[model samples]
Every structure is written in structure tokens, then in C-alpha cells.
Target: MTVVDVPGSKSLTARALFLAAAADGVSTLRRPLASEDTEGFAAGLTALGYRVERTPERWSVQGSPAGPPHDTAEVYCRDGATTARFLPTLTAAGHGTYRFDASAQMRRRPVAPLTRALRALGVDVRHEESEGHHPLTVTADGVRGGELALDAGESSQYLTALLLLGPLTRDGLRITVTRLVSAPYVGITIAMMRAFGVTVSRENTSRGEVFSVPPGGYRAADYAIEPDASTASYFFAAAALTGHETTVPGLGRGALQGDLRFVDVLERMGARVRVDDDRTTVSGTGTLRGITVGMRDVSDTMPTLAAIAPYASGPVRIEDVGNTRVKECDRLAACAENLRALGVSVTTGEDWIEVSPGTPRPARIATRADHRIAMSFAVASLRTPGITFDDPGCVRKTFPAFHEVFARTRAAWGLAAAASPDR
Candidate 1:
């Protein structure tokens, strides 16, 4: 199959915004993905009184390394949880009264852990509606940052929010995390921070983890975003479903994305995985064998992996993904419900999900308005003829050209033409 170069990592986009907002001068970011999520983040920065210039290939953000806007203002983060989560911590470090509002999907995501952590750090953060959720009003009259404890079981973004803003606090900060999930994402944040010239010291403890950042500004450098490994998971699954070899280029050997572990998942499913410095090729063995996997470290690939599990020879049980329930949608439940609709034998718990192989059934898969769910089911459709997806455009939150890329990949692999559904 033809090699596809996916867009920039969403993880990198969020971290870049955090670094850019903390930089002294204009920081030019090249190849920033222009998806809805990144757009919302850029808009949030603008609302915070930063000048962000978006171009075809790059975005130049004129930063204020000192802090956020001093005046009181309302910033609407729309459906981007990254913006909604990260911006408040930055605002808390500055002297301002800020109001944050988000779309219905974003409002559904949990934010209480972050709010509580910010409050513990002596920031005045109040929930305007449905306490612990979004529509928040934060007043940063002053920030006392020393030692703060956080419950990050719901999202790593909460820890990342505090970590990114910790350097700007008066006393810097040390964050003690309790029950941290998505640990790999924390590694990504730390790596990106180092790239921006910020040093964060982390220590793993029995209670959970501790992170420390020294008070400093970010260094502006010409940085290039790597291809999204999370997005590549769908194509890797497609190879397994269609028994075709799919090569994805630009996901280098030195790629910093933790989602690269998705390749190992494919290998376990009987797909041949070839890796080089610049490309990853997944060739299917014409049949898949199921294996139980603990997904706590690579939880982001669970949806895509589960979508392909129904085609395996045995049961595929995915565990250690309790945090998926709190994502954009109840991903564990959504995966079970959608798979069941397609006539697959599926079971789900609060945290774990299991899928059994069965005859393919043609059905219209519901995406639940989650980008990964939409793309994962699309890859599943490659095996089940007549399978359709409802509201496929939901992928725009991360991969806007997903449908086009899928079509191109299908043509290259000699698969039948599939028409895009109207959102």
C-alpha cells in the first residue's frame, strides 16, 4: 500500500502552545496541524491577549514570557480539552480574572482534579455550572506555588497543565500526583518541555509521581512536529483487516510519541512490523491471533486495537484502561456498544474491555463524536463490506483529512472505493 504521512501530533501541538505561551519572544512553530483542537488552542491564547499569527505552514506566536493577560477577560475554549485544561493553569499563574467556557462534549470531560489542584495552590477557581465540570471562572489575584497534590487518574492533562505552568509560579512548584494514568503522556510533556529549554525533575513514588520545574522561560527554536502515531494506529489496523502491507513514513526511529507502541500491538495480532529510521511498515499475515494486553502504558491505542480485535482468531482482552471512560466519550462503553452493533461478541467493565472474534456483520458504526472512535471503526470497515460510519467528520478534531487519506490508501491497496458520509 502507498505510504501516508499523517499530520502533526496533537500531543505536540498542545505542548507547543504551552511552550510558546511561555517564551520570551515570537516563537515560530512549523507544520502545526490546523485541526479544530489546535485552532481552539490558538484562539484561547488569543483570548488571553497573545498575538498568534497562523500561516500555511507555520504559526508565529508573539509570547509574553512574563505571564498571561493582566486584565479580566473570558476565553471560550470550545471543544478542545487541551485548551480548556492548560489555559486555566497558565491564567492561575498570572494576575487576572478569567472565565472559561467549552462545548457540550468538552463540558462533559472531567476537570475537578485540575480545579482542585489549582485551588490548593492558592488560585481562586470556581465552577460556574455543574460544579467540577466546565464553564469555569478563575481569578488569579495571586499564586502560591510550592507543593501541591493532584489526583490525575482521570487525565494526564491535569498534571501536564500544572507542570507547564509550574515554572512561571513564584516559588516554581512541585506536584505530587496520586494515581496518575497515561504515564506515557507525562513523558511526552517532559520531553517537549526539555526541547523548549525548561528542565523538569520527576521522581516516581509509591503514592504516585512527583514533578518539579524550575522557574524559567522557554527557548524559541525552529521545531518540526513528527507524524501522529495515534493517527497511524488506524492505518496499522487497516493492514491487519485487509491483509495488506501499509507503510507510514516520517514516523522516525527517534520519534518522541509514545503511541508508537501501537506497532507492538499489531505485531502481537500477527502483523509483521518493520521499522526503520524514517518509516514503519505493517504487513498482515492474512490472519490475526488474539492476545490479552495491559494497555495502561499505551491506552490511547486501545480503541483502534479493539476495533480490529473482532477479526482475530480468539478473544482479545484489553485491560488497565479505566481512564478511557473519562475521555471525549465513555470510550470503553462506546467501543463495546459499537462492536456489538456490528454483531461482535463484546464485554466491558468500568476499566477493562474484551472482544471475541466472530463473523463480520455489516452495520453503520456510531462514532460517538470521538475522533479515534470514528477512525478506528473506519479501519474496521475495510474488512466488513457494506460497513458505514455515522458522522465521520468527527475526525476533524485531530485528523481533518482522514477521509481523504483513507481513500488514497484504499486506492493504493486496490480496495473498492468507499464514499464519505455526510456529517
Candidate 2:
């Protein structure tokens, strides 16, 4: 048995930071993720004059309801795509001239959809050199939000940025989502917004979904973030790979994060799962059977599932994951490449990947500096030997102590196995 305590949700931490900064008073975030991406977001907010303090147990953010205190600031968003996209919207809502830059990796991602939508809302967004990329400037006298239409085909963070900024606008906002890529993330955004005391009405329309947010700003409140289910997936997959039981505490049926649904996919794949109010436990039934799944909503776990595909009883087909191509790396291609490197038969199309059972061989996986890739392949290493990673340090993006915790879990499981008389 290996019981692990996964850290807080990165998605919820990012959203909490944005909402807390725009709030009326001091907000305390309990058990928030302390990672490069999340810490980078907090630092960016601090540069805009929000007081974010991190203690051992929690983080306290002093709100700036009247908008960011600085009139001119240069903020650096590292590899965190959520920070890069969401920070610009937060800057546009303030009365300032903010310049945003990113790391070499974040520089390649798409920011045009967000900037285009902001321009429609009457904000001046300019790209310094490359258009639709990072290293841009935003001149804001405060957003005059009205009915706005935008495409979130590339990433769901675009819609989340607007939804977070909705209540702060002069006339509120009526957001008609043209095309939503990752729809379930919007649900997390909506749930977080409501927790901070704002209501956003989402209705299905002929076009897509229209979100209506009221004109009142956010209210500061003490928030407890759920464990990162995306990070927890590796451990659950480990349990499914080995005939053992693994429990991730602080996550269950009431989790606010969308990635928790990954457990449901595992259950469908022949793993026994127990979900209560406090924890989620996964027990392997000695063998895994593959299943077809649409990962648009919980696509972050695609690589993790793909890692386990070769060990399963059948083929695993993942669909509706075109957005995986534009993430930290070309995740779909990366998964296929890594799977093939391990001698697994993998097939990939524009938005789907099907992996079949094969004898996993020794291979050094190229992580492409993507945290999910590093972690996913690491999970595969538990079942098969000689699975090395090109960039193991990339796990620092979300879980800095991931390898350390994983080793401890492995040691605990080894001890359990050695002590078992049946073994």
C-alpha cells in the first residue's frame, strides 16, 4: 500500500490568485500549489502591486479592488500558460500600461485569441515583435466589457481569462463562446468564481455557450484548494500498473478540479476505485483492460493514460484531444513518439491517438520540456525498467517534489511487499 498526499490544484491556485488579487479584501488560500508555474503567477501579481505572502501552511493575498496599483509594470510569466494568458486579461482590467514577457517555451504559444477578444472589449493590446505571441504591451484604462465573441479553439484559458474578468468590467460581460476546446475547465473557472462570491450564468446556445457575468466585483474569502488530480493520476496509474492500492488524500467526489474525472476513466479501464468525501482510493485488479475515451474535458491526463496503454489487455484510443498539440508541447505527438520509443504500437491522427499492447523496451523519452510528459513517463518506469527521460527536471513546472515523493511511495510499497508473507 502506498498512500500519498498530493499537493493543491494548479488550476485552482491560478484562478484563486487572479480572483484574490481582484478582490475587495485580504484572501487566504489554504494548501495552494507551490510550483514554478503557480509561484510565477503569484510573482507576476506581486509585480502589479498585489501583496501575496506565502507562509508554511498557506498563502495570504491582500486585494486591490480599485485595480492594480502600478501604472507601468513589466511582468514575466515563465512557462505557465495559464499565467501568461490570464495575467494579460487581469492587466487589461486595470488602469495601467503593462508589458508582459515569457520564457523561451511560453513564447511559442498562442495569445492572439485572448488579445483579439480584449481589443473587442476596448483594450489596447499590442505585440512588440511577434504577433499573437508573448512580449507584448497592454494599455488599459479599465475594460468596458459588453457582449463579446471569441474562439477558444486553441485553449480554454482564453475563455477562462474573459470569465474571470467579466464581473470587473464596467457593464459586466456577455461572452458568447464561439468554439470551446476544453469545456470542463470552464466549469472549474465557474466554480472558483462562485466561491469568491460572483455568479456567472452559463447557457447552451446555438453557437456554443454564452456566459453572462454580473457587474459586481469579487469578494475576498478563505479558500481551500483541492489536491491536484492531474498530478494524482500518476500515482493512481501506478496502482493500476502494480497490483497494489494507492490512495490520494484530499480529493474525492466533491473535488472542484476537472482532472479528477480521470479516475472515472480508470474505473472504466478495470481498476477498482473508492471515492468518499475525504479521499480517493484506487486498487489494481491484477490486470488492466483498455477502453476508448474522449479526453477533451480531462485531456491533461492523456499522456498518463497513454503510458499505461502498453500494459493493458487491449488497445487504448483517446479522442477529442486536438488541443493536446498546442499545450506545453505537442503532447499527442510526444506521447506517440515516446510510446513508439518503448516499442509500443501507437497510431495518431489530428485529434486522436490509439495505443496497442507491446513489449516496452529500454528507451530515453524526450520530454520536450513538458511537465506532464516527464511525469507520465516516470509512471511508466514503475512497471518497466530502462525508461529514461530527456528532461526529468521539467516536473518542477507543476510538482517540484514529484520525484522525491514518488521515490518515497515506491519505498513504502517495497516495504509493504517485503513484509507480506504471500510475497
Candidate 3:
């Protein structure tokens, strides 16, 4: 068996930074992910006059319950949607003029719903250029939260931003979500908020599901982040495709991230999956079975499944991932294009993709500068040699050492299989 240690969760790391900043006292984050997106979030905190200390394995932040110390600040969010959306919302509870911008690609993504919701709460939000895009400013005088409605069909980051802002408000916030995608991500936010000393309430109303966040702010503590489950999908899928057993620790039955459920998809593909309290293992059964799955909540792993679909016995159909259209790139289109380059038959709808079984040919995959694109296709390279990435270093957005770690893990799997080929 090949045991792998993945980095801490990016979703958790970003939320931890925000919670640590909003808490009543000092907060320490252990095992937080060190990547371009997360590091940029920390940098945004620092620009807002929050004291954030970083180390090799741990990060500490001094909270300011009153909001940002600086009255005026300019923050540049690299490629992280969390930083672009959440940071500005975090600033809305303070007294300041905070201007937030992002990368060219991030600016193209949607931020209107979050900003509109912020405006309805009596905050002043000004768009620098596009009405619903980034390069925006938030003029804050504190928030008196109240009943509001939002649409989260395009992205869940908008809802997460407001949920994080609830405790910082005067009366708290009660949000009615009309259309939601990636519901599990909101669960992660509420869970992390509870960790920082706040509990958000949820209920199904006639209008929609209402989330009630109470005021009193967050309390600081030493928080430990879990391993990123989305990043683990590639390794688990690689094992399933190559008929090797691989184990990733820190993502177990109690793991908070929703992407860990990708193991269930592997099990459907004829892999033996063992889920324990502290770890989960995936061992290939020497066969790959194609499956049709709805990925509304676990859409991040869609590409991972798509990359390995060609090896399955039947057609693999992934549905309910329309939000993927506005992600780092058009993921459905990217998957279909890459699969075709490998000589596999594939079809894509607005929100669904069906990949047929075939012998994948070696080809250069265009990553579109998206990290998931590169990591997913890397698993296909395990069986189909000569597969290369157009942009290999794009994995830095999440896992900086992905190539190094994956290479070592791949080598260990080879040795393990050679030692016991019959197993």
C-alpha cells in the first residue's frame, strides 16, 4: 500500500484566516495549506492591518472583533475566488474604504450576488468597472444584519461569504437561498464558524432554506485544518486506474470537506474503498466500472472522474455540474476536448458530460491554467504514458509540491505492485 500525505484544505485554510481575524482573541492554525490562493488570503488579511504570522507548518493570527484597523486599504486577490469574495465581505463590518481586485481570470468570474446582498444590508459597494465584477470597493460603517435573499446557483462562495459575516453584524443575518449549488461547501463554512465559537442555524421555509447566524462574534482557539480531499481525488483515482492500493491519511469518516465523498465514486467504479475514522483507503479491484453520478455537491472531482472514465467498461456520465461552466475554465468543455485528443469518444451538455470507454492515446493536455485540469489528467498518465500538460506548474494554486509528491507516490506504488504482483 502507498500512503500519501496531502496538504491541508484550502477551503478550511481560507475560512480559518477569516475566522481568526474576526475572533475575540488570538488564533493559531495548524497544518494550513501553503499555496498561491491561501497565501494570497493571508496577504489580504495583512493588508487590512490584521497581524498574521506564518511559518513552515503553522500560521497564527491576532483577531480584531471591531474589524480592520486600517481605514483605507487596497488588496489584490490573485486567482482565489474566496479571497476576492470573502475578503471584501469581511471588510464590510469595519469602518473603512477597502478596494478589492483579483487576477484577470478571477475578475471575469461573478461576484454580483455577494455584493448585492452586502448592499441590501445597508453597506456601500461600488464597482470600479463592471457592475457585477471585481475591481470593487466596500465602504463600511458596520453591518446591522437582517432578513435577506440570495441566489447561489452560479457559485457557493457568495453564500459562504455572508455566512461568515453573520456573527460580525449587529442583529446577525438570516439568509434565504433561492438556488444553491455546492451546498456542502456552505456546511464547511458553518462547521468552521462553530469551531470559532459561533453556531449558524438552518431551516426550510416557504421561500427557501433560511440560514440564521447569531451575533456575538467568534472566539479564538488553536484550530487544526484537515487534509484537502479534492486534492486527494487524483491519487485515489490513480490507484483505481492502475490496480494499486493507496491510502491518504487525515481525510476519514469525520473529515469535514464534502469532496472526500469522491471515494464513493471510486467504489462505484469497482474499486475497494475502506473508510475509517482516521483514514480512508482505495484499492483497485483490477477492473474499472463506468458510472453515472450527480456531482452537484462534489463537482471539484468531476475532472478526476472524467480523466479516468475512458478506462471504465461502460460510459461514465457526470451530471448536475452546471456551475462548472464559470469555474477556472469551462471544465466540461475542457474534459471533452482532452478526452478527444486522447482518441476517446466524449459528449458534453451545459451541465453534464458522458465519456465512453476506449484506449486513450498519449497527447499533450491543455490545462487552461486550471490546477484541477492538470491534476486530473495526471492520473490518466499513469496508464497512458507520454501524456503531458500544456502548463505543468499550474498546480501551485493548491499543491505547490504536487508533481514531486505524485512522482514519489507513483514510484512507491510501482515497487509495491512489483513486490506482490498477484495482490
Estimate the lDDT of model 3.
0.92
- In candidate 1, position 271 carries an lDDT of 88
Give the Å error, residue 292, model 1: 0.1
1-423 per-residue lDDT for model 2 (tens digits): 578999889999999999999999999999999999999999999999889999857999998876888889999999999989998899888888999999989999889999899999999999988999999999989987899898998899999999999988989999898888777889999999999999999898997789999988999989998889999999999888887899999998888777888888889988999999989999988888979999998999999999989999999999999999999999999999999989999999999999998779868889999999988987787777666777778889999998788878777777322111111
In model 1, which regions exceed 4 Å deviation? none
Clash number by candidate, in order: 0, 0, 0
Question: Of the candidates numbered 1 and 3, which has the greater lDDT value?
Answer: 3
Question: Which residue pairs clash within candidate 3?
Answer: none
Poorly placed runs, candidate 3 (over 4 Å): 415-423
Q: Give the C-alpha miss distance for residue 48 in model 1, angstroms.
A: 1.3
lDDT of 1 by residue, 216-240 (tens): 6677766777788999989988987
Better candidate by lDDT, 2 or 3: 3
User: For candidate 1, what is the TM-score?
Assistant: 0.97
Residue 273 lDDT in candidate 2: 94
Best by lDDT: 3
Rate residue 317 of model 2 by lDDT: 97
TM-score for each prediction?
0.97, 0.97, 0.97
